[model samples]
Target: MNVMIFLLLSIICIGLIFIIHKYFGKEELYFLAIIYAIVALMMSFKTIKIFGIDINASIIFDSGIIFILYYFIRKYKYNESKKLMLSILICMLITSMFLITTSIMIPSLYDEFNFSYQNMVLDNLPTIIIYPLSLLITMSLSSYCFRQLKEEEDYRLIKTILTIIGITFIEVLIFIYFSYAFMIGFKKALIISLNSYLAKVILMIIFTIFLNIIFKVKKVKE
Candidate 1:
């Protein structure tokens, strides 16, 4: 019954994303939605029980999705070479394999750790902050690398940066929704959802400014 509800929720979210993609005409976001759906499906099948709260392993996998998006942006915006793309793909594959192996080998490792709800939530607070920060770093790194190889015209650069910001915004919402919706009731989930969006939006604004500065430097160079 739980699995069925999860699957249904996944389908509904994916459908909404597709609709947004269609209306917004962002092919990259469409792909992002699809990747998110894949992660959600994986969560439906397996979850880690921490402090009697079920957390999806797929949250870790969501980080991989951000990396994948970085690759996509690199390829499209900078015409990243096939060899480098292949190398990235291989690295992601190997990392995923290692995670899967570790999960299988030590499924019950955390089960022995007694955790109070307050302690568990406190422990997870850092992760909640770290995940979004890591995502920002990924976006920044991807943009920096691509800009080193090829600098777009000023207008194109702005468009690219905006797209990255928009995608980051969506990514934050998706991550927060998946992480909390199952753990909290609707009211608390709504509060977390708002806070999460605000946090990520601030991060996005900061990063977007940083990107703009880099683009200005590139323009000055050219």
Candidate 2:
């Protein structure tokens, strides 16, 4: 299935996240989670063709989800919001990837790989809502942890969140660029691949800078 539209949309979403980050910085992790959902929703849809019943396992445009999920697991423990929230994101990312890959590898015994917007709406709407709630819970825990640690640093949560999200976005941009570069179908492939990587990287870096400023402001306030 041709997922060009979804790819375009995902890149746009990344850009939107950067803009949002510039204005509202403390919610960096929360915003990143939302961006992941939007991009993943499309990739998840495109991957449905390949994944079958486990359509949720697929990753469409890139692999940023891996880093976010991993960082969450490694950083926080059961009591920690960052750790728990990241764990949930990790589970969803993995589950979604599994669903997508299984569909691709296995013959379509269950669902079709249409990758329509309606399909994504039906499948991911609930998943998306669920993530934010989980994020909220995680955020609460993080607040507690920070208070306990009493870290003098300003925007402690914001910085950590931005760092995690930024790194993940960067990793994904790399994966997508490399994946496309190797898959030589024609000249357009290289052009598309290079453009995709550059756009995402630039957007992510911009968000990081904005996030840094947010942190600075928070520290000053403290």
CA lDDT, every model vs. true structure:
0.44, 0.42
Q: Which candidate's TM-score is highest?
A: 1
The ten-residue window of minimal lDDT in model 1 covers 213-222
Task: Score candidate 1 by TM-score against the native.
Answer: 0.38
Q: Residue-wise lDDT of candidate 1 within 98-199, one digit each (tens)? A: 534444443353665433433443434433433444444444555465455345555655565566556655554555554465555556546655554554
In the range 1-222, model 2's lDDT, one tens digit per residue, is: 334654565455445444543454334545465466555544533322221222222232233333233323333443444554554456556655655555345344464554443344445444443433433343444444434433436775455555545443443334332333344344543454445444544444444454345434332111
CA RMSD per model (angstroms): 15.3, 11.6
Please list all clashing residue pairs in model 1, or write none if there are none.
none
RMSD of 2: 11.6
Instruction: Compute each candidate's TM-score over C-alphas.
Output: 0.38, 0.36
